[model samples]
Target: MAGGGGRSHGLSSSRSGPTSNLLFSCGKVAIVRTVKSGPNVGLKFHGCPLWPVSV
Candidate 1:
């Protein structure tokens, strides 16, 4: 029996092959953290490389 869930289409196609690169690649990856503002501050977090950056 074959496992079902993800589809083999678009970037998932075997022809495309496996990759470790990002789709909408950005300059560099950065560590996102929370601000110490009010009660929702100083919270460290992770985020995309192109969060608030524009090419």
Candidate 2:
């Protein structure tokens, strides 16, 4: 039961995006992603675990 209007500005501005084993601003676990198919393949990025994507 969440709306799509509570997205935070800080989440979108995360240039680093999806770091491995990192903590979000809310103290949650971070979801890191590795590029498997791109020029920057194998690159790791950091992201928040509690981002309101479907707020």
Candidate 3:
């Protein structure tokens, strides 16, 4: 289970093989959070405004 901002993300899978189920489950949750928050976070590029700049 993964918790953030009073929310919880959980998963259940029953497949075992070369792929690690535990690792895949955790990675999925991380990806979701990253994608959800990525746009709101600031960019690392130089000379760029937090918001877009228009002429």
Candidate 4:
């Protein structure tokens, strides 16, 4: 039988597809980004417009 719970398993499908627009928590549209450094360098993914900000 399938398991059921209130907790999310981090396997939910996003309503936005590859061609669809993805928005950030700040309400800004997410942008495609490329990793500049580290083991995942050159790895492309979606990012926020207000990233790398100083607190």
TM-score of 2: 0.36
Residue-by-residue lDDT tens digits, candidate 3, 1-55: 4345865334444577534343233344122222224665642321112123365
Order of quality (TM-score): 4, 2, 1, 3
Q: Which residue pairs of candidate 3 clash?
A: none
Using lDDT as the measure, which candidate wins? 4
Measured by TM-score, the strongest candidate is 4
Error of 1 at 5 (Å): 19
TM-score for all predictions?
A: 0.31, 0.36, 0.16, 0.60
| Residue pairs of candidate 4 with colliding backbone atoms | none
The residue-by-residue lDDT of candidate 2 on 1-55, one tens digit each, is 1356877534333457545344555666666667679798998866565544785
- lDDT measured at residue 33 in model 4 versus the true structure, 0 to 100: 92
**lDDT score, candidate 4, position 43:** 85
Q: Summarize candidate 4's per-residue lDDT along 1-55 as a digit string, tens digits.
A: 0367675322333577767666665677777799999998998877777778889
Q: After superposition, how far is residue 26 of candidate 3 from its true place, in Å?
A: 20
Q: What TM-score, to 2 decimals, does candidate 3 have? A: 0.16
lDDT of each: 0.45, 0.58, 0.35, 0.67
Q: lDDT for model 3, please.
A: 0.35
